[model samples]
Target: MADLGAGTGLFTRLLLSAGAARVDAIEPNPEMRAELEAALAAQVAAGAVRVHAGTSEATGRPDASADLVTAAQAAHWFAPEPTVRELRRVLRPGGRVLLVWNDWRGVDAPLNRAYGEVVAGFTEADVPPLATRVPEAELPGLLPGGFEKRLFDHAVPFTRERLRALAGSVSYLPSPGDPAYAAMTAALDRAFGEPAGGEAPLVYRTHAYLGRLDG
Candidate 1:
């Protein structure tokens, strides 16, 4: 399996936990690759997870080398056409491509709604909304076969500090020293006020799109 844009090996670790024979974590960012290597050092040393500094369009892997190619929470950053071509190149005949994202379900609750507003306020205009960016209907045109969608509902309980950290993790959001950073932090504090249990819920609809290439 090839896990593209495997930041910090989050999905790579999941694959390992699920008993995958091997996983190639391909991350283009130097910092992210370094973190992934450090986080999964044991797996790397055991020859279970291999780290590659590569992008979705140029994986630097042999033809038909992977049985499955996966991109989790990272496909939005890729050029769909080139990524699909690259996936086809690296995947064996009839191999599958899986695109997954933890889609925030804002309408589910007040906490979720507030979180969405906080994110939107901080998010740059160049960043596209995940909800509308990848239209499920158009996925089939990008690959040999059409794609199938699966959704799983889940929630993460976040304390105030964790929520702030989560907000800070948004790539387009202003950093600590930036002028807008203070404002964003202020808004987050207001939106994610102290809950009775000291935590708030962030719900997600895990979206999975699976497609297979023609042999």
Candidate 2:
């Protein structure tokens, strides 16, 4: 199986745990790949997971080599047409491609709403929203064949500090040295205060889209 844009190997670890014989985790970011390697060192040494420096549009794997391809929370950065072609090239006959994302479902809740407001204040108008970029309705056209969509609901517990870190992790958000970083941090701190139980709920709808490629 080929895991494209396997940032930090989150889904790769799940695949390994789920009994995948071998997983090629392809990541272009050096820092993220380093972290993935460090976290999955034993798995790498065991020949269960192999790390590659590559991108979704050019995975560098031989044609028809992978039985399955997957991208988690990273497909939004890819160019749909070229990426679909690359996925098709790497996948064997009748192989499948799965695109998964953990969409936040607590937008209407108090803490989540406040957090959204804080992010919005810092987010640039030109940056496109992820959902619109990789819409479920359009996945079928983007793949070699049509696709199916599924959603699973889950919740994560996070403390105030974790919440702040989550907001800061957004790619488009200003970094520490940026002028807007201080204001963004202050706003996030105000919006997300310490919870009563020391942990707040972060509800998510895991969206999974699966499609197959023709031979």
TM-score, one value per model: 0.88, 0.89
lDDT of each: 0.82, 0.82
The reply for model 2, stretches above 4 Å from the true place, is: 105-107, 131-133, 195-197
Report how far off residue 88 is in candidate 1 (Å): 1.5
Candidate 2 steric clashes? 0
Clash totals, every prediction: 0, 0
Candidate 1 local Cα displacement, residue 74, angstroms:
0.9
Q: Per-residue CA lDDT of candidate 2, range 1-215, in tens?
A: 99988989999999998889999999999999999999999999999999999998899999999998988988777888788888878988888998888877434566767777888888878876663247765666556577778888777887777776786777788877789988888887777686434877777778888887552
Model 1 stretches with alpha carbons more than 4 Å out: 125-127, 131-133, 141-144, 195-197
Error of 1 at 177 (Å): 1.9
The residue pairs in collision within model 1 are none
